[model samples]
Target: MNMQVWASLFGVVLGGLLSYLAQFTTVRVAGRNEERRQAAQRAEARRAERLELLREFVTIAQEGIRVAEERDQAPDWAAAGTPEWFAAGRSVIDRLWVAERMIQILFPPRLYRLARTYASAVDHVLWRLPDQIAAEGSMWHHLRDPQHEFLEAARTELGAHP
Candidate 1:
């Protein structure tokens, strides 16, 4: 080939190679960005699931507290232990047990420990005699401190607070 033709051929090949490389690089970078975005979305979804689980646990535990208080108020609760009272109390405890197990499985060690502490406080209220509960006043009073600690830990873990 003549010098002009050879030069033209070289330039065409060089330009084509560079264009192919640029397109390949762009596709690779785009693929990586897409992967990162998908990972972030999955992490956020897991966080949302954790939040829902914690909320459910708190609700069940609070119900337990309410049932305990109601039992304390009943005149025949401690003495006769009516079938209705036992049934209500048993229902709360059963649900609380399930929630506690879930917390144990899904939460980190610190949160699980705090949750157990709070559950213990609830148990104290439930098992206490009427006179003992009366001595302390409201059932909420018994649960307030432990519940506060548990919620604080949960909020911190959930990144709800800075």
Candidate 2:
């Protein structure tokens, strides 16, 4: 081939190669970006789920505390031993126990331990007799510290710490 023809042929080959490389790189980069976006979405979904579980657990814990307080404050009713009151207290404890198990399965060890401690405290309060509560100056009062600790840990874990 003539010199001019040879140069044109080489130029075409080089341009085609460069174009292919650019397209390849663009596709690879786009693929990576998409993968990263999906990963981030999955992580956000998991965080939202954890937050919801924590909210439920906290609600159950609060209910347990309320039941304990009611039993403690209403000495006459407690002494009369109405089945409904005991039943309510037992139901609260049951729900709290289930919530604690959920936390143990879904949360880290530190958070689970805190949840266990808080649950135990609530259980103690719920099971205490009125006389025992009076002697101890309110079992719910004793539960406050553990509840606060669990809440703080949960907030930190959920990245909503204040």
Candidate 3:
């Protein structure tokens, strides 16, 4: 072949190789960037979910305390087994049940167990409140240590230092 023709062929091959290399590099970099963006979005979503769960758990705990106090102070007409008493009890129990289910679904095993323990303690206290109130005549106080423990565990699980 002529020298000019050989040189032209070389130029064409070099241009094609350079183009391919540039495209490959661009695609690889874009793929990596997209992966990083997706990972960041997932992390944010998880954080939001954890925050929501914490809020829900806190609300449940607060409601449980309120209901216990109300029940303890209720009038004789609203005594245990009455519609008012049962309604108050059901509301607190239902909220606790929902928190328990959420913890089971959203938390790791360790956190789940901690939350479960708190829920169980609250449930036991509520269940026995009527008898305690009847036997002690409005002088009973529910134990709330488990609630504090669960809150601490939940905070730690959500990446808080506490």
10 residues in a row with least lDDT, candidate 1: 73-82
lDDT of each: 0.85, 0.86, 0.74
- All candidates in order of TM-score, best leading: 2, 1, 3
Rank by lDDT, highest first. Answer: 2, 1, 3
For each candidate, give its TM-score against the true structure: 0.85, 0.87, 0.82
Q: After superposition, how far is residue 2 of candidate 2 from its true place, in Å?
A: 4.1
Off by more than 4 A, model 1: 131-138
Question: Positional deviation of 138 in candidate 1, in angstroms?
Answer: 4.2
lDDT of 2 by residue, 2-110 (tens): 9989899999999999999999999999999999999999999988888888989889988988876776667485474578878988888888889899999999999
Worst 10 residues of 2 by lDDT: 72-81
State each candidate's clash count.
Answer: 0, 0, 0
User: Residue-wise lDDT of candidate 3 within 1-162, one digit each (tens)?
Assistant: 699998999999999999999999999999999999999999999889878887887777667756666655656524534776678878978988887888788888887887877777666656555666567543223345666677788778777794
Q: Scored by Cα lDDT, where does model 2 land?
A: 0.86
- lDDT (0-100) at residue 74 of candidate 3? 57
Top candidate (TM-score): 2
Candidate 2: residue 66 lDDT (0-100):
83
